[model samples]
Target: MSSIDFSEALDCLKKAQSVLISCHVRPDGDSLGSAAGMAQMLGSQGISAEIILPSELPDRYAFLFEQARPRVVTDDWRRAQLRGFDTVVIVDTSVRAQLEPQYDFLKSCNLPVLVIDHHLESENIGTVELLDPSASAVGLMVAELGEVWPAELSAGGAKALFTAIASDTGWFRFPNADSRTYCQAWRLLQAGVRPTEVYRSLYMRDSVGKIRLLGRALGSLELFCEGRLACMSLLKEDFRQSRAAQTETEGLINESLRIGSVIAAVMLTEDENDSIRVNFRSKRQINVARIAERFGGGGHELAAGAQLAGSIEQAKEKIVSAIREEFSRSGEPGGE
Candidate 1:
């Protein structure tokens, strides 16, 4: 993939008087943090910036957006506001399908579209793109951009950016976290971001319902591919019984990977439209992103996800089979 120069992206942002920043559906910490931090950074430069998300902001991330929470664009009135902006910055994700609700509206807009992301595979959906898979998170790329640009980041922006990087890198435990990631983290700390505060806000503050949901998810865990792969499914009933929102399923897939023998983990949840949302995580060596791409989804090597057009059972069978085949080809044997 061709990489867009950071300077070019900075120039594009400087030219725009107002920019609308957005991210994929079921917004994650990386997306939310990057969008919020970008908005804050742009605002500091005297540019009118706003963050519009396709889904509700998760409760855990509400603090990062307390100064100015992102607006959810689910209706025409909200969609109409897009016309007022001269630039649209799509952060964290570059997939059109992931944008949801806002995908069609963004396509209809005549303004310049700028994509800032760190995904492995990206759709050619933006007029100006800045994609670097080497970066730990889109927030780190944004932090780098800020360093090169004239605008100064506020304390809130630093915290938001820190959350983006920390969450995406699994708090520096993931393989994606390199020296540059640590350097960016140090830079953010210097910019007035409190590591302890951000860490507690993102991870330590779990709700009772969320804990119940996790219990349900863990109870459903099953092993496949000679214990190399761990799989779990959470049905609609799980959400209702646990009184937990779908967003609470955020970190459940990783829990499966904690098993020492499990090189890969998959979580399938029943979503709206009778489809299944699948999240894939790998401990090492496996390229889950390729599997996700084959299923029309995309992400990093160890972490990726896809939304399949089937029920939870069908999704589990198909995905498990795929993973088994992949493991077999890689010299591992056995499946269940």
Candidate 2:
């Protein structure tokens, strides 16, 4: 729970004529949904709001904003537009490094930054931050803000927010999903969001290339710590062979944790820069966020990620060793 008052954020929003909404790099459903929903909410109040993503929007979520797609800032000219806003709203992430393309521009801009997020660890980047680690997702927090502000959500906004909440909470299966989460879902449904339609669009629309990529990822699975830890790798060649983009790897890590014997799962993917992107997921008590922070990344407790500056083999060795040490210190069954 952040000590910052939500009223202060509302006051800032009330005075602003224009707003720029952004999220972390490699934006996920929650990030995109929150941004799009927030933009619509602000627009309903006659405020000009635009979203700037650090990278291209993944194909799956592009439907959330059919007519008003967010601008993906790639070069300096597009990035420079961030300075034109009266207020900036950072959603789903507060980590500075996560805002790569706009980081320098945002730092130089003499504007108020309002952060709305649900992560446990956050950098102090916003003048007014509404952060609740207990919330299932940032969309939940945004919904609560809508109630506080008495903002009327359009049908599209409701659908986008539902996508945000559903994606981040694993469709209400994650531990963070609570009574309030369901209540908000109900509210969004009342506002004309069709859950089945959203679910079909999100889960049932995978392509053949994504399935091939999943096969390659599963083929690379390896077990350690006597089956308590499962690790998988997706090489740069995997993408080429499968004709799959990196975004297709989104849910692969969780698949490794499905085995009955595995307590923790790690997905190591070779990035274009030759670095390894590490994604972590745990079933029970492991705090993967702490593990990610040790490697200069941060996320939630059960689900987290980090980028390692090394070969995939080196990253695997280091991360496996760290997981082993964690198990030993915690007196878990896998400790040797």
Best prediction by TM-score: 2
Candidate 1 residue pairs in backbone clash: none
Stretches of candidate 2 off by over 4 Å are 1-5, 78-84
Error (Å) of candidate 1 at residue 138 is: 0.2
lDDT of 2: 0.89
lDDT per residue, candidate 2, 225-315, as tens digits?
A: 9999999999999999999988899887888888999999999999988989999998877888889989988889889999999899999
Q: Model 2: clashing residue pairs?
A: none
Residue-pair clashes, model 2:
0
List, in order, the clash count of every candidate structure: 0, 0
Q: Compared with the true structure, what per-residue lDDT tens digits does model 1 show for residues 197-260?
A: 9989989998888899999999999998888999999998999999998789988888887898
Query: Model 1 scores what on Cα lDDT?
Result: 0.88
Candidate 2 all-Cα RMSD: 1.8
